[model samples]
Target: MIHLLYLLALLLCVAPLIPGLLGVVLPAASWLPPLGLNSPSAVAWQQLLSWPGLGESIALSLFTGLGSTLLALLFTFFILRRYWDTPQWRRLENTLSPMLALPHVAFAIGFALLFAPTGWFFRLLAASGLNTDNAINVVQDPYGIGLLIVLAIKETPFLLLMSIGVLQQLQVKRLLAVSTSLGCTHHESWHKVILPLWLPKMRLPLLAVAAYGLSVVDIALFLGPQRPSTFAIQVWHWFNEPDLQLLPRAAAGALLLLAITLSVLLGLRGLEWLLVRGTRAWQLNGPTASTYCGLVSTSHAVNGRYNGAGSPQTLHPALITRLRGCATALRRRIPLFAPFVLIPLLVIPTLLVWSFAQRWRFPDLLPSRYSFRFWEQELEPLLTLTGHSMLLALGSGLIALVLTIGCLEYKQRYHRAIPYWILAIPLVTPQLSLLFGIQVATYWVPGQHFGLWVFWSHLFFVFPYLYLSLEGAWRSYDVRLDQCSRSLGKTAWQTWWQVKRPIVQPAILMGLAVGISVSLAQYLPTQMLGAGRISTITTEAVALASGQDRRVMAIYGLLQGLLPLLFFGLAVFINRRTSRYSSPYSSQGHGPSDTSSTHSGSHHANDTVRG
Candidate 1:
C-alpha cells in the first residue's frame, strides 16, 4: 500500500514534467501537426534571434534574476547573523507567515502604490513644497531595477525560512559556543564556520528564487521593464499573438527561456561549490590564526621591527583598532528590520486606504474624502473571483498535503526517498516553459477539462512547497517513539495516528497554509490552462493592473492579499486549540514530573518545526 501511494505521488508530481518538456520541444522544432507544419527546421530559432529588442529583453531577465538572488541572499545572511538565537528572532519568526502569505501580485500592486511616480513618497515630497516632477521612477523602470528590488524584497522571507531548517541541522547555538571558546566573536564565527555549511544546504532554495525571478510573469507585468520587457514576458506576448504561424516563435522563446533557467541554476550550483568546497582553506583557517597574524604584523610595523627587506608589515595597531570600531558602529546602526518587515507593514495599510479613497489626490497624507462606494461596486465580482480562488486553493492544498504525508511515510518505511532535484524541478524550472507544453498536452484530450487541468497544475506547484515545509518535521521526529509504540503491540497505522500525527500536527497545518497560499498565487497556470474562463483573484488583479482605475485595482489587490492570510490565521488558531489537549505524554499515563520532561523534550525536538 505504501509503495502504491508513493508511486501515485510520483505520477502526480514528477511525471508531468516529461510530457511538458516534450510538448515544448516538438513545437519549437516546428512539428505542429494541427497547423500542418511537420518539417523539423531551425526557422523558429532564427525568427527568435531576429526579433526586435531580443537582446535587451534577455539582458533584463538576467539582470533581474541574478541581481535579485544576490541581494536576497545577502539580506537573509545579515538578518540571521543579527537575530538568530536571540529573543528578537522569535518576534521576526512571528512575522514570516503573514509576509509569505502576501501573494507576489498583491505585493507588486502595493509596491506600486507606495513607489510609483504619483505614489505616497512623491506626494510627501510635493506636500513639503519640493518639486516632485523630476523624481526618478521606480515602478516599471526600463532598466528593470524596480523589478530587481521587488523580487529581492519578496524573496528574502523564503530564504530566511529555508535557513531555519539548515541552522537547526548545523546546531548553530552549539557551534557558536564552541567558536566563542576559541576567542571568535559572533560575527567572525558566522562567516568562518556557519556560512559554509549554510550555503550548500541553501542551494535548492536559492535556485528556486533565481528561477522565479527569471520567469515570473504576473509581477513582471506590474513592475518589470516595458520598452523591451523581460524575456519571459516577451515569450508570453508571443504566445498570445493571434497568428498561429507565430506559434513556433513562442515555443522557441520558451525553449530559450528554459535553457537560460537551467544555465543559471548550474552556474549558481557551481558558485556554491566554489565557495564551500574549493575554498576550504579559508574556512578551515581559524579566526584566531587570522587575527593573530594581523596583530603581529601590525605590532611589527608599529615598532619598526620589520625584517631585512625593510617593508612595512601592515597598518599600525591603533589604525586597525579604529577601523574595527568604525565597522562595528556602522553595523549596529543599520536598520535590519526595515526592508523585510517594515515595508510589508506599510503596504497593507496603503492598499486599504487606496481601496476606499473617494477624492484622494497627490500631496495628501490621508485621503481627503473616503467612502465605501468602490468596495460596494466591486463586492459581487470580488466575491465570485475570491470563491473560485479559494476553491482551487483548498482543493489543491488538501490533495498536496495528503500526497506529501504519503511520500514522507513511504520514505520512513522503505528508507528511500525521491531525489531532491526531481521534487525541485517544479520549483526551479521556468513556469512558462512548463505550462506552455502542458497546455498543449491538455489539448490532446477530447473535451474541455480546463478546471481539472488548472487544479492539477496548482497541485503540481503546491506539492513541492508542502513537501519541503513538512520535511523538517518528519526528519526531526523521534522514530524511537514509533518503535516504542510497536513494542507496546500497537499497529503501524495506530502508532502513526495516535503517536506521530499529534506531534507533527502543527507542521502539517502550517504546510497546508503554505500550500494554499502557493495555489492562490498561481497566475500562469490559471490563465493559460483555464483559457481565460477561470478568473481568480490573481488573474483579476493582474488584469486590473493595466487599467487606469486605481480604485478597482485596489479592491482586487486588497482581497488578493487577504485571502491567503485568512487561511494562515485559521491554521494558527487550530494548531493552538488542538495543541492544548494533544500532548504526547497524555497517552502514556505518565506522572506529572514525567510529563514535564516529555513536554520539554518534545519542545526541543520541534523548535525548528515552528516556522
Candidate 2:
C-alpha cells in the first residue's frame, strides 16, 4: 500500500514535468503541429534575438535578479551578526513572522503606495513645502530600482529564517567562544568563521531568491519598468499576444529564460565553490588582521577588556569613551530596521484607507472624503473572486498536504527519500518558464477544464512547499511512538493515525497554511492554465493594479493579504494550542523542544520558499 501510494504521489507531482518541458521545447523549435508549424526550425530563436529591447530586457532581469539576491544576503548577514543571541534577537524573530507572511504581490502594492512619485513619501515632501515637481521616480523606474529594493527588503527576513536551522546545526555559541578565545573580535568571528560556514548551506535559498527575482511577473508588474520590462515580462507579453504565430517566439523566450536561470544558478554555485574552496585567503585571515581590527576594536570591543556591561573597575576611560561612541553609532545604525518593519505596517493602513477613499489627491495627508460605495460596487465580484481564490487555496492546500504526508511516510518506511534537488527544482526554477510549458501541456486535453487546470497547477506548485514544510516534523518525529503502537498489534496505518499524526499535526497545519498562501499568490499559473476563463483575487488584483482604480486595487490587495494572513493565524493558533496540550507530554517524547524542532525544520526545509 505504501509503495502504491508512493507511485501515486510521484504520478501526481513529478510526472507532469515531462509534458510541461516538451510543451515549451517543441514549440520553441517551431514544431507545434497544432499551430501548423510542424517542421523544426530556428526561426523562433531568430525572431527572439532580433526583437527590439531584447538585450536590455535580459540585462534588466539579470540586474534585478542578481542584485536583489546579493543585497538580501548582505542585509541578512548584517542583521544576524548584530542581533543574534542578544535580548533584541527575540524581537527580530517576532518581526519576521508578519514580514514573511506578507505575500510579495501585496507587499509590492504597498511598496508602490509608499514610494511611487505621488506616493506618501513625496506627499510628505509636498506637505513640508518642498518642491515635489522634481520628485524622484521609484515606481516603474527604467533601472528597476524600486523592484530591486522591494525584493531585497522583503527577502531578508526569509534568509534570516533559513539561517536559524543552519546556525543551530553550526553550534553558533561554540564557534563564537572558540573564535573569540583565539583573539578574534565578535565582528571578525562572524565574518571569518560563521560566514564561510553559513554561505555553503545557504546555496539553495540564494538560488531560489535569484531565480524568483528573475522570473517574478506579478510583483514586477506592480513596480517594474514598463517601456523595456524585465526579460520574463517580455516573454509574458509575447505569450499573451493575440498573434498565434508569435507563440514560437514566446516559447523560444521561455527557453532563453530557462537557460538564463540555469546559468545564474550555476554561476552562484561556482561562486560558492570559489568562496568555500577556491579562495581561502579571506577565510584564513586572522581576527586581529589589520584590515578589520581597527574597526572591530572600537565596535565589537566586548571581548577586549569590557564585558557586555561597561563597569568602572573593569574598564578604562579611553575604552569607555570608545565604547560609548560605538554604542551611539550602533543605536543610530539599528533604526534602519525600523523602515523595513514599519513601512509594511504603515502600508496595511494605507491599503485600508485607500480602499475606502472617495477622493484622495496627491500631497494630501488624508483623504478628502471616504465612503464604502466602491466596496458596495465591488462586493458581488469581490465575493465571487474571493470564493474562487479560497476554494483553490483550500483544495490545493489539502491535496498537497496529503501528498506530502504520503511521501514522507514512504521515505520513513523505505529508508529512502526523494533527492533534495528534485524537491528544490519547483522552487529554484522560474514559475513563468515552468507554467508556459505546463499551460501548453494542459491545452492538449479535451474540453474546458479551466478550473481543474488551475487547481492541478496550483497543486503542482504547492506540493513542494508542503513537502518542505513537513520535512522537519517527519525527520524529528520519534519513530519510537510508531514502534510502541505497532507492538500493541496495530497496523502501520493505524499506528500512524493514532500515534504519529497528532504529534506532527501542528506542522501539517502550518504546511497547509503555507500551501494556501502559495496558491493564493499564484498569478501566472491561474491566468495561463485558466485561459482567462477563471478570475481569482490575485488575477483580479494584479489586473486592477494596472489601472487608476485605487479603491478597487486597495480592496483586492487587502483581501488578497487577508486570506493568507488568516490561514497563518490559524496555523499559529493550532500550534500554540497543541503546545499547551502537549506540555505535560515532554517526558513521553512530546515537548516544547520538539515543537521548536518542527518549526525550525519546516523553516529550514523551505529555506528558499519565499525569496
RMSD of 2: 5.0
Q: What lDDT score goes with residue 238 in model 2? A: 95
Per-residue lDDT tens digits for candidate 2, residues 1-611, read: 66776787688788888887888898999988778887999999999999999999999999998999989998888888987877667666666666777788888887888787777888898999999787779889999999999999888877877787788789889999998888887888898889889999888878888999999899888689888999999899999999999999999999999999999999989988887777578667665457465876654555346546763234566877787799788886665466667877777887898899898888898899999999999999999999999999999989888778878998997887778878788888888878888888877778889888889989888888788787876777778888888889999878877677666666677678888888999999999999999999999989988866888888888888777878877877766666455422322323212222222114453222111
Span of 10 residues, lowest total lDDT, candidate 2: 592-601
TM-score for model 2?
Answer: 0.91
Q: Which candidate leads in lDDT? A: 1
The TM-score that candidate 1 achieves is 0.89
TM-score of each: 0.89, 0.91
RMSD of each: 5.9, 5.0
Residue 403, candidate 1: Cα error in Å is 1.6
- Give one clash count per candidate, in the order shown: 0, 0
Can you give the lDDT of residue 171 in candidate 1? 92
- Candidate whose TM-score is highest: 2
Off by over 4 Å in 2: 291-333, 583-611
Positional deviation of residue 20's Cα in model 2 after best superposition, in angstroms? 1.5
